[model samples]
Target: MLAGFEKSTGKPPEELSLPWKGMPDLKTGEETVEIFRSWRPHSMLFNLPNGNSMALSHEDECPLHPRSIVVVDDVYCIFLGMLLENTCDLRSHYGLSRQVTEAMVVVEAYKVLRDRTPYPPDQVVRDLQGKFAFVLFDARANTLFIARDRDGCIPLQWRMARDGSLVCSDDPNVIAEACGNCCTFFPPGCIYMSGDHPLNKIRAITWEDDEGNISSVLFQVDLFTRLRSIPRTDSSANWAGVTTVDGE
Candidate 1:
């Protein structure tokens, strides 16, 4: 998997040399799809949002990924981040504009797969670094998969320590900080997963009340509290006695 990812990305796997033999694996090819679906489930976060987004980051400037598809245990997932540069209707479901739609098309596309894949728990984390991200989960196969844009603007890494635990990183320092070892980077447009992590719990966020008036979601008190935080430059003292006799 790592080798294929390297070839696809045109570089060796982020952490391994010519090959990536260090990654973990659990042979599940022989398992029945129904049995696998009933058992361990995973998540697929192709390019998850960095969670720290900058307002200045423009859509046209973002990196674009070619239309591609990868299969995880016969579960098919595809990625086509945008229909064209800075334009997409994908986010109409979320009430975002075309640029925001194209910008988030990658994320929404991944989420669509993640939701359909039917993984156990957060077994597959389809995290996005910022520029682009996607994920596909196959609860029926206990596998998670992903892909990313070509640019290095986004970050991803993982590492194994003396204890055999796999430590992942979005920031390089996290690996060394937690594992006391150097971290390995996940190649761009590559995939990764965690095996044997039980998914006994899964929480799905659902929206049901768009029917509720907008006022129901708004809190005037909160707005007033925020307004109070603004610095005041003018005062009542300035107008205490400034009125002209003729009111001119």
Candidate 2:
């Protein structure tokens, strides 16, 4: 997977050879955690089933870029950047107190949208006014959700390792060192999710109203990197659209 990613992105192995040398094996949770910790000693790491893991650092590496991790109910979220608008309203809507963190609000938002909202997940993301990027995992539902703000305000990149584990982070140099040329920027104005749930589920990616009428909210990036609503019956529409950006 890593090799294929590098090839498709036009990054030759020789260019990445130097960084690839003396680098710890990133496929293991232990080594990956150490690599991230080397960058931010205060970083918190969460190891998931399979070789997947998540690391978050509360310390700001860049101005206005704060990283936070919150687990509410069974949902786990790692958020980078801030919610500059509607935060108070969101807290009120979720019945959360002022003490609740913004990361907590994000998890609540996902819960509401997944379980109750009639709108599609992407629409909810589009309506958010903030410079943010996040990765959410719902343990109970066995789902994964990822999104970035529309303007690409906060940096986010992801790569699939040779062992098929997905890696994501805001630091490009770390990604380059670990994933070589395999990494690609996670597109702005986009959301990547997994599972059969209505919110992020691409399988039929539809919403049913109280009246039982179904409407589609599925979207995909075309070859031109433009986002377009896709029909439910289009089986070819897959999560590959997440990395279908123009440059990569």
Q: Which candidate comes out best when scored by lDDT?
A: 2
Best by TM-score: 2
lDDT of 2 by residue, 1-248 (tens): 11111222221213112322333564432444466778777667666543345777655466687777887887778888888778888789779999877788878778887785443455335445688888877766656677787677887866544433455677765666665554455666667665222322222133444765432223334444334433333233332223322221
> Model 1 misses residue 95 by how many Å?
11
lDDT accuracy of residue 160 in candidate 1? 32
Each prediction's TM-score versus the true structure: 0.31, 0.66
The per-model lDDT (C-alpha) reads: 0.30, 0.56
Q: What is the model-wide C-alpha lDDT for candidate 1?
A: 0.30
After best superposition, candidate 1 residue 71: deviation in angstroms?
22
The true-versus-predicted C-alpha distance at residue 129 of model 1, in Å, is 13
Number of backbone collisions per candidate: 13, 0
Measured by C-alpha RMSD in angstroms, how accurate is candidate 1?
23.4
